[model samples]
Each structure stands twice: as structure tokens, then as C-alpha cells.
Target: MDRTIAVEKELTPVIQYLSEKGYKVESIEFGSDYSKNIDKYDAVVVTGMNKDFLGMQDVVSKIPVIEARGMTAEQVYWQLNTSLKQ
Candidate 1:
């Protein structure tokens, strides 16, 4: 199955890179209600600096979250790819 990833809005470069690699990518805002929507994705790529914006820990515990802070688009892509391999 194609890997579906939810990427935070601030990581536009990462989104573009993932899209180019053929992964289904969705843009999500930092403070949005992700409880109902998060399950649709296999993983989430967020900025480490904005990790708290997703709200309570319970809401994000459902899936693996990859922090993209201080990383390039290629690095983020590799990070997400590695996470999926485990």
C-alpha cells in the first residue's frame, strides 16, 4: 500500500519532496483537531519546535511521529523512510 503521511504546514519543502517520491501526503495545521483525522495516515512528520501544537499526548500516541526540525527535505524524507522500515 502507498504510505500516507500527514505533514505539518510549515514543512512545505518536505511535503514537496514526499509528493515527488509518490507518497500520499496531506498538509495539516499545527493546532487542528487531529483525533479524528490522524488515523487516516500511516505516519506524521512534524516540526520538533511545534510538537506541542498537536495537543495532548493521547491524541498523538496513535501513530509514529517524525520530527523534521533543523532538517532538510531530503533528510526528512530519509527519516520518514527509516521509521517505516522499523
Candidate 2:
């Protein structure tokens, strides 16, 4: 099965990179609704600049999340890749 990842809409570069790399990527807007649907993805990535946009950390406590703040797409990709390996 293909591993699916959920990326915040603000991280367009990361989203594009992951999509190009053959992972199933889903664009998600941060809000109350996001928490409700978090289960649909294998993991989540968000720009750490704005935590308020993502509702609350408690909502995603069980999900693996990568904070891609101030990082290049390549760096984000490698971080994601490493996370998946574990």
C-alpha cells in the first residue's frame, strides 16, 4: 500500500516535493475540522511558524508530525524519509 502524508496548505514546496517523490500527498487546511480527519493520513507536516492555525497540538498528539519551519524542501524530504524508515 502507498503511504499517504498530509501536508499543511502553507507548505506548498514540501507538498510538491513529496508528491513528486511518489508519496500520496493530501493538502490540508488547519482548523477544527482538520483534527477530525487526521486519521486519514499516515503522518502530517506543517510549517512551525503558526501553531495556532493547526487548532491544537493535543488533537494530533497520536499522529507523527514534522515541523518544517525554515527548512528547504530537500531537507524536509529527507526528514520525512527518515521518519518513515523508523
Candidate 3:
């Protein structure tokens, strides 16, 4: 089955790359909307920017949350894939 992923809006390169790889990609920002429907996605890619300031309050899930800070899109993909396998 094609995996669905929620990615941060700023990660355009990552989004495109993942989409090309046949995953259903949805652009998302950390907020009420995402928190409400977090379970729908297999994983989430976050920028990890201002996480402390912005706060992901009350948001919790078993899915992997990839911090795409300095990592390349390929690296992020690898990590995501790896995490899901286990």
C-alpha cells in the first residue's frame, strides 16, 4: 500500500522527492488542524524549528516524527523508510 505522509510546508524538496517515490504526501503545519487529524498520516516530517517556541502541545502519536533539520531529502526518506520497517 502507498504510505501517506504529512510534511512541513517548508520542505518542498522533501515533499517532491517523496511524492515521486509513490508516497501520498500532504503539506502540513504544526497547529490545531494537524493535531486533530494526526493519526491519518503514517509519519510526519517537521522542520524542528522553533519547536520549543511554537510548541506541539497536546500532540502525541506512535508514528515517527522526522526532524528534517540539516538532513537532505534522501536522508529523510531513508530514515522514514527505515523507521517504518521496524
Candidate 4:
């Protein structure tokens, strides 16, 4: 299956960078829009700006999730690549 990363508004840079690296990523800003289908992605990357998602920790926990706090686009780029190997 192809890989994807669930993201939000503030993390568009992360998504764009990941896309350049060949990852299929989509961003959903509304917390209410998050669904089980998000789990189909290789991972779910949450931006620090999205405090709304904090309440959905239960669902987010069901996948290979990455929550970045004030992390730069470069950091997320390297982080995702690094984590995918483990």
C-alpha cells in the first residue's frame, strides 16, 4: 500500500516536504474530520499548533504517530525519514 501522512494547517510545510520526498500526504484542519481512514496512512503527523487534536489522543494512538512541537520543516523532514526506518 502507498504511504500517507495526516496533517493540519500549520504543518503544511512538513506535508509539502514529505510529498517532495515521495510520501502521499493530506491535511485535515478540523479535528472533527479526523477518521479511522487516517490510520491507513503510514503515519499521522500532528503540528504543535493543533491543540484541538490533543483531545483525540485515543484515536491517534492507533497508528505510527508523530507529534511535533515547534519543530522546523527540516526537523520534521529528517524526523519522518529517520522514524520510517525503525
Q: Pick the candidate with the highest TM-score.
A: 3
Tens digits of per-residue lDDT, candidate 1, 4-44, equal 99998889999999999989999988565876667778899
Alpha-carbon TM-score of each model against the true structure: 0.85, 0.84, 0.88, 0.72
Q: What is the lDDT, from 0 to 100, of the residue 57 in candidate 1?
A: 55
Q: What is the alpha-carbon lDDT for the whole of candidate 1? A: 0.83
Q: Supply candidate 3's per-residue lDDT for 38.
A: 83
lDDT of each: 0.83, 0.82, 0.84, 0.69
User: In terms of lDDT, which candidate is strongest?
Assistant: 3
Worst 10 residues of 4 by lDDT: 54-63
Query: Which regions of candidate 3 are displaced past 4 Å?
Result: 52-55
Counted clashes in each candidate structure: 0, 0, 0, 0
Stretches off by above 4 angstroms in model 1 are 60-62
In model 3, the Cα lDDT at residue 25 comes to: 96
Q: Of the candidates numbered 1 and 4, which has the greater lDDT value? A: 1
Candidate 3, residues 1-86, lDDT tens digits: the string is 48999998999999999998888999877776567678888998989885631245555678888899999999999999998898
